[model samples]
Target: MSERTVIPFGPQHPVLPEPIHLDLVMEDERVVQAIPQLGFIHRGLERLVKTRDYMHFVYVTERICGICSFGHSYGYSQTIERLMGIEVPMRAEYLRVIWFELSRIHSHLLWMGLAADSFGYENLFYQCWRLRERVLDIFEKTTGGRVILSACNVGGVNYDIDNSELAGISQIIQKLKRDAKPLIKALVKDRSIKDRLVGSGYLSQEDAVKLSIVGPFARASGVEEDIRMFGVGGYGELAEFKPQTSTQGDNYARVAVRCNELLQSCDIICEMIDKIPDGPICEKPKGNPPEAQGIGRVEQPRGEVVYYVKGNGTRFLERFRIRTPTSQNVAGMVQLLQGCELSEVPLNILTIDPCISCTER
Candidate 1:
C-alpha cells in the first residue's frame, strides 16, 4: 500500500489570481481527497449593511469582485429598487444588458488567459489578454471605469449613450469578434491545449446537479440552468437567447462553454444596441423605501447572483445578503478535485474559475 502524504496548495499560488488554499491528501502522485479552506481574505463586507446607507451600499457591493463588479452593483440596486417600488426606465434596462454582456465577455477573456497560463502556455495567455483590453476600453468609454462601474443605480443608470455611440460600440464588437478568431482557434484546436483540458476534472451531469453547481461549470456538465432565461433585465426582449451547454463535463467543456457564450454575449450586446428605446435613462424615486424586503437576481459572468435587501423605512438597510456564484460552486470544485493526480489539482480548481474575493465576501 502506498503511504499517504498531505500537500498544501495555494493562498499564494502563481497561477491563481486570488487566494484559495487546498490541503490535498495524496496517495503517491494521485490526489485522494482535497480539503478546501477559506478566511485568508474575508473582509466582513456583508456586515457593512449595518453601517452604510442603502444608497451608498451599491459602491460597497461593486467592490466585492472586480470581474463581476457591475453585476453585484446591479443586483443590489435592483433589490433596493424593487423594495422601493421604483420602476427603472426602458432605456436603462436595455443599457444594463449592454454593459452586463460586455462585462461577461471581458470576464471570459480574462479567465481564458488565466487558464492558458495555468497550463504554461505563456504566449496564448498574452494573446487572450491583449484581446481583453479592447473590452476594457469599451467599459472605460461608456462607464468611465474599467473594472468597477458606478453607472448602475437604484432607479436606473447614471450614464447614457447616444444612438450613434451605441452603433459605434456595435462596430467595435464586430471587429473584436473578427480579431479574436485566431486566438479562439488556437485555444480550441491546438494539440497541447486539448491534451491538458480534454479529460481533466470531469464532473458528471448527475454530480453537478447533486452539488447545485452554477454558471458555465454546470452548463459544461449538461445541466441547463442559466438565470438569464428568467428575464430579469432586458433578457425578455432577447427572445433568441439560448444557454450554452456541453455534455462532456470536463475542463475542455467548461472552456468551450465560456468561449461560445462570449460569441453569444457579442450578439446580445448588438441586439440590445439595436433595440434600445429612446427615453429617460432614469426615474426619480418618490420617497424613502417602506419597511419591506425584496430579492434581486442577475445572471453574472460567473452565474446567478442573488441580492436580498430588507428595508426599515430608514436610510440604512435593516439587512443585506448576497449569494455569490463562487460560494455555491465550491462544493463542485471539491468534488472534482478528488481522484485526480496531484499535478492536476491546480488545473482542476482553475476550471471552476473561482473568484475568492467574491466567495470570501
Candidate 2:
C-alpha cells in the first residue's frame, strides 16, 4: 500500500503571482484530495462603501483585482446607476464594451504568459508578454493606465476616445490580431506544451455544471454559458457574439479556449468601433439615491462578477457585496486537483487562472 502524505502547495510559490495555498493529500505521486486555503490578501474593499460616497466608491471597487479592475469598476457603477436611476448614453455603453474586450485580451495574454513560465518556458513567456504590451499600450493611449482603469463611473465613462483615436485603436487591434497568431501557433504546436498539458487535470462537463464553475474554466469544459450572452453593457449590439468553448476540459482545453477568446475579443473591439454611436458619454444624476437595492452582473475575463448595493438616501451606502468568479470557482479548482499526478499540480491550478486578490477581497 502506498503511504498517504500531505504537502503544502502555496501562499508563496515560484510559479504563482498571487498568494493561494493548497493542502495536497497524496498517495505516492498521485494526489488523492486537495484543500484550498484563502484569505491571505483580503483588503476589505467591499466594506469601504459605507465610508466612500457612491461616486468615490468606484475607485475602491477598481482595486479589487488588478487583472479585472475595470470589470469591478463597471459592475459597481452599473449597480449605482441602477440605484440612482441614471441612464448612460449609448456611446458610453459601446465604449465600455470596447474597453472590456481589450481587457479580456490582455488578461488572457497575461495568463498564457504565466502558464508558460510555470512550466519553464521562459522564452515563450516573454513572447506572450511582448504581445500583451501592445494591448496595454492601447489602454495607456486611451485610459492612461495599463492595469487599473479608473475611467468607468456611476453614470458613464470618465474619458472619451475621439473618432481619430478610435481609428488608431482599430488599427492597433488589427496589428495585434496579426502579431498574436505566431505566438498562439507556437503555443498550439509545441510538443512539450502538449506533453505537459494534454490529458491532464480533466474536468468533465457534468462535474463542471455540478460545481457551478464559471468563466473560461467552465467554458473549456463545454459549458456554453457566458453572461455576455445576456447582452448587457452593449454586448447585444454585437449580434454575432458567441461564447468560446472546448470539449476536452483539460489544461490544454482551457488554454485553447482563452486563446480563441482573445481572437474573439479583437473581433468584438473592431465591430464595436465600426458600430459605435455618436452621443454624450455621460449624464448627471437627478437626485440623491432613495432607499433601494441594485445589482450588477458582468462577464470578466476570469468569469462572472456580481456587485450588489443598497442605498439609504445618503452618500454612504447601507450594504455592498461582491461575488467574484475566482471565489465561486474554488470548488472547481479543488476538484481538478484531485486524483492527478502531484507534478501536474501547479499546471492544474494555473488552468483555473485563480485570482486570489479577487477571491480574498
Candidate 3:
C-alpha cells in the first residue's frame, strides 16, 4: 500500500549465531512485513523415531538442541516414563531440577553475552562470558562436557551429586550471584542499553500470546508460562518458586528478565543442594511397554519444547513430533520486526534467542 523495497535480513549475519533467513518487505526504511524461512537444517528427527529402539534413541533425542541438551533428554525420558507407567525415584526428581535450572542459567548467560555483543558492548560481553565460564565449569564437573552435557537418562539422571559436589556447586552459585551484580547493572539499568532496547520492536502481550511465543520472549512480554510454575521436577516442593515476568516486551525487558532469572536459578540450585534427599537416582523399567503414546513438554533454555511420541508395543515408535521454542517463536519475530528500521531488524530477531539449528531440526 506504501512505497517499498524488499530487503533480506539474514542467512549469515554478524549478530546472529545460527542461520535463519528472513525476507523483509519494507516501506521506505520501515519494515512492513517479514517472512521467515526455516527447514534449512531440519534433519527429520521425528522420522528417526520409528527406526531406533526406545532405549537406544534417547541419545538421538538429546541432540534436539546442544544448548538445551538436558531438557531434550528430560523430555524424552518423561515421555518414555509415561508410556511405561514409571515414576522415577524421588532423588532423581530433584536431580532433574538441578540440571534443568543449570541449563537455564547457562542458556540465559550465553544469551546475555550475545545480546551485549549485538549492541557492540564488547566489555560487557566479555565480562558476561567470564562469569558463564564458572557455570560451564560446574557443568563439566557434573556432566563432563561444557555445552552438550548429556546428563539425562531414561528413568533418571546419569550421575549423582555427592556431598562434596553439592558443597562445591553451592559455593560456585554464590560467587556467580556476587559477580552478576555489576553486569546486571550495566545491562539492566544502564541508560544506553535501555535507549536501544526499550520501546524498540515491541510485541504486545495479546499478539505474543496469539503467536504463541515462549520462554523469555513470552515471559519478557509479561506472559508467565514457565514449566517451573507447573511444579514439575522438585520445583513444586520449593519454599519459594515463582515465574519471572516483565511488561515492556522489548529487548531491554527481555535482558532484564533473564538477568533476574539468573539469580533465581542460583536460588533453585541452592535449594536443591539443601533439600536433595539421599537415595538411588534411577529406576529400572519393568519391560517394554505395550502400544502407548506420550507427550512431554520441557522448558528449554530458549523456551518450551514439546515432544509427542507414539510407541507401537515394540522398541520403535510410530510417530515422534518435536515442537521447538524457536519454531513457535518464529512467527512472533516477524511480527515484531514489522515497521522496524533496517538497523533494528537484527536486534529484534536476536531478542527471541532464535536457535535456527533446533528449529530446523
C-alpha local distance difference test of each model: 0.89, 0.90, 0.85
**Which scores higher on lDDT, 2 or 3?**
2
- Tens-digit lDDT track of model 1 for 271-316: 9998999999998777666798898888888887888888888788
TM-score of 1: 0.98
lDDT of each residue in 219-313, candidate 3, tens digit only: 99999888877876567778977778999888888888888889999898889888888889888777775687788778787888888888787
**Per-residue lDDT tens digits of candidate 2, residues 69-96?**
8888888888888888788899999999
lDDT of candidate model 2 versus the reference: 0.90
What's the CA error at residue 90 for candidate 2, in Å? 0.7
Higher-ranked by lDDT: 1 or 3: 1
Clashing pairs in model 2, backbone N/Cα/C closer than 3 A: none
Off by over 4 Å in 3: none
Positional deviation of residue 208's Cα in model 2 after best superposition, in angstroms: 0.6
* Residue 54 shift from truth in candidate 1, angstroms: 1.2
Cα RMSD (angstroms) for every candidate in the order listed: 1.0, 1.0, 1.3
